[model samples]
Target: MQRIGSLPSDDSSPGWFHTSRLRQPRPPLIGDAQAPWVVIGGGFTGLAAARQLALNFPNDTVILVEAQQVGFGTSGRNAGFLIDVPHDIGAPDYIGDQANAKNILALNQRGQHILRDLVEQHNIVDAQLRHSGKYQAAIEDKGIAVLNAYRGGLEKLGEKVQLIEGDELKEHIGTSFYRKALFTPGTMLVQPSALVKGLADSLPENVKLYEDTPITAVDYGQKTTLHHPTGRIIADKLILANNAFGQYFGFLQGRMLPIFTYGSLTRPLTAAEQASIGGKDFWGVIPADPFGSTLRRTHDNRILVRNSFSFNPDGRHKPGYTDKVRQSHRLSFERRFPTLTNVEFEHTWGGGLAMTRNGQGFFGQLRENVYGALGCNGLGTVRGTATGTLLANMLAGKNESLTEFLLAAPKPNWNPPEPALSIGVNFTLRTGQARAGLEA
Candidate 1:
């Protein structure tokens, strides 16, 4: 039996979750329950796994457990891009080997297709799912060079891209802060909280979802048992889709890094304030530098600025961390929109991101009757869904190409112990952010 050590306990409320319409969360697990399949974590991966399992095994019972409401976790705290291409945050050019990049693109596209279908089928209008594409914008010369390299890589992959600059770029994004940008029309933007909530609410009837139920311990075997505060679950098979917290379950130790990224959103801009920035109603911009700030104009006329990374092994941030990060976000936002001086951030929050030394994620059987799909690097929105769906398909004995591809993917490399790991990670993050300069 493994005693879970830590769980996600963010100190701030995500702007995405705060602005979303509130709904009654599914009741917490109570007493005891038994199911053919049990999934831990109610984020993107667990939700996808539970839904797919139900679809694959209609007669079997699938149970999904969450420590909090579905949209209140990391899944709803992202910049809300359903990226359809390779977005390796560790890579200098956001592209690795050509062959591997192609495979990743296909997998991400598959995930996007799955989500698009669900949004249409369920009529989840609040999700704000749109194929708005996205821009990789650069402010400095160094950042511009990075964007040029990224554009070259995309063109090599036979993907369509457009270069927008000067007045034209300002007209589109309402920001003269960027010197140039590479626009790719494959990525989809969304209200991540709404999307995850919709997916959870529309889950198949065979899949039972319980909220605010944190697994306290686990006994792994042919028939695994998971214990919570007031309830226990016995299942023939168990899936751990909890990302970095998977280490607490006695797996992926010393292999995964729990990193936190922060974001801040302003209250909806007034009509006059919106006109001050002459641009489209909504658009998203990713910095050319991986460590730089990510900006978005929401459908309801608000600006979101996301940046800063921290090494937090406990899967939680310290008190006042969000306030510190929000200061940095304010600088980033002000630099881009100097005219919106009076605009203030209404919400600021942070989310955990699971990373690995080699940028590889764990996928496949971890032990007897137990499997895991986690460490999504920084692209959890799409990668998490893809790996989760593929994992369920693999368990169902579906011999599809994507499933095989995922099973063959490399796992995270081991990291040095303790102080050394922390020291190295902190140094890298600080230096990277410093180099991002005005981009941040």
Candidate 2:
């Protein structure tokens, strides 16, 4: 249908999450022709859509193919924080269609519930998932205003959120930097990579999954075809769930600019150390300041921290780490909890997130019935899940609510290094960092 930027078949993840976390049997590709439905990208959105389709429509043969193993993308490599609402700090403007935005939000909440039910029903213990509330802390007056405005809007808009300020905040999260904070109790945290692996393993036989089979080129038409090295996939419909690193699909790349964010996990703390920072009961996030971070404690007893942003000129991993922008984004951690100075991270990693020029998640037809979803911005976990399903449903001729609110196609590839993304990213990040400091 639409075109995506070029992406390499090889992935860039260090052996961090894979070695220690994700555990799913990588399925091999049988051949080019699969069922009428084929989904690309094995991340949460892709897998979710794949499983949902097979469960809802048992007769449809669904094939899901991934360039690498499961949970290999940002979906699995992400810091383990799950906020129920489908929202991005920049979403108000990014999602210009208000009706669509509302539907996106509702769908995200439903997805969260869907995940929770699946984890419980299947007893997905490897995910080590836990239900812990998350906080949107206020760093300054403007930040507080933003949180309050969001809280007010959510409350008026019928979003299930509770606003806590002043002393009430102390009872929830012990961060003093926040003058006020908004709380969402329905969120759950998980070992993201593990969760993805678990989901993939739970797929029904009707949903064929393949790894190590990368598509060399995507030939789209009434019946979309994906070309692989030894095989090809010809399906009645195709769905591209690649957010960042989605460049490989001729339809995704420059259409959605990929931006990177860094995250580090702290070694588990002793009882004394745990008390020093607040207890290990929750996760926290600041408003969306491009560099803004979201953090949480995992069921494995480690602190999973995510913050800061990065860009690779090559659009792949940079060689030997050319530059280090901020000394330590953990400063936000230290400022909020001084005791973290003594804490150390067992591992640190980062991943790219995709976004379009307009900031909306890209969805809709590429051609006759084929569809693509991209641009999760910062909240792709939920947004991707929402878009992945919406796109799948559209191909199936089921849901049209999201389609109705979808926006005009953004000027393709206007944002980046797909043709020249690195330069754009470096310039935009520097400017954004400066602006954030001034605003701070």
Which candidate has the highest TM-score of all?
1
Once superposed on the true structure, which residue ranges of model 1 sit more than 4 Å away at CA? Answer: 89-93
lDDT of 1: 0.91
RMSD of 1: 1.1
**Cα lDDT tens digits for candidate 2, 157-211:** 5667777777666555555555666776767777777777778888888998888
- Each model's TM-score? 0.98, 0.84
Clashing pairs in 1: none
In lDDT terms, how accurate is model 2?
Answer: 0.64
TM-score of 2: 0.84
How far does residue 336 in candidate 2 sit from its true spot (Å)?
Answer: 3.0
In order, candidate lDDTs are 0.91, 0.64
